[model samples]
Target: MPNHTLVNNIDHKDTKIITERSAAYGDDIWFTQTFPAEYRSVQAYYPIFFTKDENTGRFFSVALFGFQQNENLFIKDNRWSVPYIPLTHARTPFLIGEQALMEDGIEKHQRVLFLDEDHPRVNTEQGEPLFLEFGANAPYLESMADMMEVLHHGIEDHNAFIDMLVELELLESFTLDVELNDRSQHQMLGFYTINEDKLAALSSEVIAKLHQNGHLQPIYMTLASQSNVTRLIQLKNAQLGL
Candidate 1:
């Protein structure tokens, strides 16, 4: 239930948003939506995986932060411990949306900036201002627009990439069973990952096709990112005082 509205300087002239990384601002997320374009950075610090939306049955890429629900090991003392926060996580309270516009007696849809009025980060004072004295966008606001642009295109590209993986029979459901330092057992389910066996078994022709389509590098990056799972385990253990 996001209270999204097309951004306008007049309607939101005094709006200021906190840009700090803190759990109070809702940064304690277990995972954030991710895409192939961000795999290189995201994979370096977090394990990349996929989950299917129960309502839509659509697949989404994600960067993992913790092993279980509602747990984010990265948040310690209300500060994010990681350097490379995913764009999707950083771009809170703002999103790209479409609006109908009329031009020359014809109607068309145009992309517009939307902000969540109900987000905790949004406030009227003591943060980055959305506009200047004369209705000009603030510097930080401009940066947010750039980030939103990248995210908008990245989401489109990622949807196609996921489709390609599914078409090639490269996606498989995986279950992770973990034993904590205290000998506590945990099991993670309902997530998907690329099948390395299927990927390696592909013919040269198919590999060439994947390469031509700009999907080959990200595929390898996702595979290499599995190594980061051990890092996640270490973080969890540290959080547990092990």
Candidate 2:
């Protein structure tokens, strides 16, 4: 279970978060949730794919890190091998939470930063400090706040983006079967990708709508990112010494 609490300097003034990237800090993840705004950067190094939540059936984008569950091929020597790490993974132990606020005598809910006290990254000493002398936020904490803000808006837009894809019936089931340099075979199931054929069949008017609404670029980016699967396979083969 997670013990998450609102990050207050008064209560957690001496707390420090592990800035190091390692499996101990929960960095051994095969994929992380991503958004359309990040496809350009994320697609460059990792294969972008869509997955659904079995409980809610909500579609979400992810950046792949490995071929199998809980395998992060990018981690070596306690470091992330890739230059670009997904924001969702980098923001571990801290997430945006809703809180009530009073403004102009009106009560409203707003997103606030919350830290998981029980997470492996949280500790009384070592790594980045959450606060400085006189209880001011540390530089890393300020960056996390900015990241949470961007993630909040990005996720809000992702819902509409998914809705548009559903309306257009552009999502289609996909399966990836691969044989590494070794004799081992792997099959990936229960994932979805953009239907290029259906995308090409869209009428000009609809295509223009997607283009004007900033969805077209991400669609193409996703398509382009499929090429990076070859890179991922190579990484896997290297890991297997195949």
TM-score: which candidate is best? 2
Instruction: Report clashes for each candidate as comma-separated counts.
Output: 0, 0
Give the per-residue lDDT digits (tens) of candidate 2, residues 45-127: 99889999889999999999888888888898878887888888888899999999899999999888999999999999798
Candidate 1 lDDT over 136-226, as tens digits, reads 9989889989999999999999999989998998999999888889999888999999998999899999999999999999999888888
Clashing pairs in 2: none
Q: After superposition, how far is residue 216 of candidate 2 from its true place, in Å?
A: 0.2
TM-score, every prediction: 0.95, 0.97
Clashing pairs in 1: none
Once superposed on the true structure, which residue ranges of model 2 sit more than 4 Å away at CA?
A: none
Question: Which runs of model 1 end up more than 4 angstroms from their true locations?
Answer: none
Report every candidate's CA lDDT: 0.89, 0.90
